[model samples]
Target: MKDTVMGTLSQRLEENQIQLNQLLGKSTDLVTKELQLDSSTHIALVYIDGLVDTQVLHNSILYSLQEGAIQDQFKDLDPFQKLELLRKRILIAGDLSVTHDFKQFVHQLMSGNVMVLVDGTADALRIGLPGWEDRNVSEPNSQSVVRGPMEGFTENMRTNTALIRRKIKDSQLWLETFQIGKVTQTSVSIMYLTHIASPDLVQEVKSRLGKIDTDSILESGYIEEFIQDKAATPFPTIYNSDRPDTIAAGILEGKVAILVDGTPFVLLVPTFFVSFFQSSEDYYQRSDISTLLRFIRFLSFFITLFAPSFYVAVTTYHQEMIPTSLVISLAAQRESVPFPAFVEALLMELTYEILREAGVRIPKNVGQAISIVGTLVIGQAAVSAGLISSAMVIIVSITAISSFVIPESGMAVAARIIRFALIGLAGFMGLYGILFGVFLIILHLASLRSFGMPYMSPIAPYRSSDLKDSIFRFPWPLLKTRPSNNKIQDLKRQDTSKREGSAYDREK
Candidate 1:
């Protein structure tokens, strides 16, 4: 079959019977496929709402056709050479691209590339002019901070890739594209520094991606679970972020990043235990402030994971763990509540989770109002009604607030779920339960390997040099070497030891 250009996709779609419509995902973005077949012929066009540049398609192909389009002379060119020539000389007709595979052609079309099909042609002409309106780069909503690069990943993959390219201008930086998802045909980009990345890890990731047998992949989360090292683990084996700077940093550190179309968040593989405790701001701020913040985040993470368990163990089985005055206060508070410690904690946790879930699912403008009202109504109203003690309210509130301190929201969420199991254990065996839970968690973390690198990384292997970047912020100059745990062969990042935390801080 031959590829043809038409003024209108409707021209190829005889009878003007081309069909188009949006997709069924919960997201409001537009996606559609149009099929124009009459009696015996068949052709289709697909495009994502904002992703396809229809004007470009019209101007390039339609204008060329109306003006008696001239086809490039690639008579001696092979298919590959012909494709390249079309891209270079012919289809420079604006943003039009040409493709061969029917499935891939449809995929491109859905992604906002216009498709042109002529009668009796086996191949389709796929045009590239993605014009999807994306939000301008801004600070990540979940990872907002006063310091750090304000640029965030946009939903558009091209824009997201550009952001990283701007950060690391090395020619070794590589971006490999693959169309994942059997039906959804989502575009995923695997990026890494060619010289620094481990070949084994790259192969492993590619193999895992090739094995993903899913009909749809809406976001990086879908790709994460499908390619996760383990199926049933509370810990997140893959790291994800909405910040371009974060992904760029990961890439520089010999880590690989996965960028999926249709989502702003990208995936970082072989993430170490220390990464979850880190914030993008840590690298942007003064080392003293960064270290302090890191310490606080670590402390807050423990509070999120152990606070309720600590409370339950002390109040229920180990009253001796509580001070005498505190014990009396707890007793007084519980006297008015009709539930046992386990029941009370469970009820409050479930309530908080429900409130949080509802808050997020609600409309954007109303989400904050719902959260405020829900918290006030649940905590204050329950306290006034003597249904829950004010002390328990405070404990739950503290736990929720602490959870937010974790820079990685996905890991924080996993920790929150596991906290309940820890609480149950604590209620049964007092401090022993907490210790047992922590022991298991630590063991699991130590045993876990992400693309052959230990999940605990510098801690598990115990590299003193790499420790400079873990759990504490060392001066940028001091971190002259890459983390040995990343398994990057050329591990030296820089040799300049003449550096303080910041120029401003030093001047002060």
Candidate 2:
């Protein structure tokens, strides 16, 4: 007992119990029950209180061992033989493993597994009895859809994986598990299609995950930030979703998904910039309608990013670009405002952002009402008080509304941050500065990579094959091949012989 916890088990049972208590600090929840097999052998059960199922412990392990018939069978065997018999015949649990390492024993015990140690054996049996509380599967709040699966991922990793497994039942679907975080020992899992995903990309993902040596990983964001390609850029290289169908779709597209234990959001790797604009409902609805909606989203992205900056530039520098009547109206509106165009735009944008954040942070019952009424009242008051022009208010409102059109919040936030920088540049150098900013932004996007895949794939490098599903999605019948930009091993998604001719051609 004095040497180390890793030492071989002593023939005396009391010494083992004493060493376990010393290592565990004799916590109140650490239950250790001692039992005797006739007059020769002894055994102990060690487990945490709330983590284990008491009903199973009583009816499965304790009741079976306390029976006279079971004790009679144990009396004829040695300690090692008795332990083997207990594991093979006695335990009613589905999963059980034998471990000799002291560190692994403690780890299993803390993870809600019951440990059974014999009087004279070095190895111990770990019984699975996890009974922790968790939320039930429900609809996703962030990425809701009009026509698709309503079921979303819960905090449980097994449940999340099962959700995906239920959707895609292919034999080639592979799942690999890892234990990260030295202190928390969080369970992480990566899943991909064996036939579709690149083996090199899988190896690179495993290599990066192995390099993480932090003390804790509370959320998937921690892993995302640690393993992403560019840490300096505002653009997100990794895509995250709480919908199982979305994750399953990514797997089918030759992408890998990382599922963390304690969070519902799963991270998808090798994501392209176009993915943020796509939604789960896109594939469910008609391709023509989905394509039109996608085009609107793309238009809204630019409007959200450049609306205020364009206004500032046109008013302060390029007045000739505006029509005579519209210019007269804009000039008349701003005549009452004391501040310059840039200052007025900045002030309105900041105020709207504050109100949006306040609405989110407040209680849900009154939050929406307050945000709506607050915006209307504040806008009217500012215009009447001559604090900001009515035209500037309208511009900020349109810009704010356009931001909600983007499917992903991360990309929308990047647009919000870049908008201010564009506004500043426009204030000094006008339209030329705005053009320069757009060039630099595109340059940065072209330079970024996610797990060796181009961030602006099928656009910057210009892949004609991938354009079928880029800005506008083609019909499902026409999309017979996978994206070539991902460099996947499999190129053909379906057989072209199954494809039929269009209705017009058939009629002719």
User: Best candidate per lDDT, number?
Assistant: 2
Clash totals, every prediction: 11, 0
Give a tens-digit lDDT track for model 2, residues 87-205: 99987664888887777777788888898898887778899988778899999988989999999999999999999999999999999999899878899999999999999999999
Encode model 1's per-residue lDDT on 331-387: one tens digit a residue.
887788888777788888888888888989989788856654576578878888878
Model 1 clash count equals 11
What TM-score does each of the candidates earn?
0.82, 0.95
- Following a full C-alpha superposition, what root-mean-square deviation does model 1 have from the true structure? 6.8
Model 1 regions lying over 4 Å from their true place: 1-51, 68-91, 95-107, 115-125, 365-373, 497-508
- Best model number under TM-score: 2
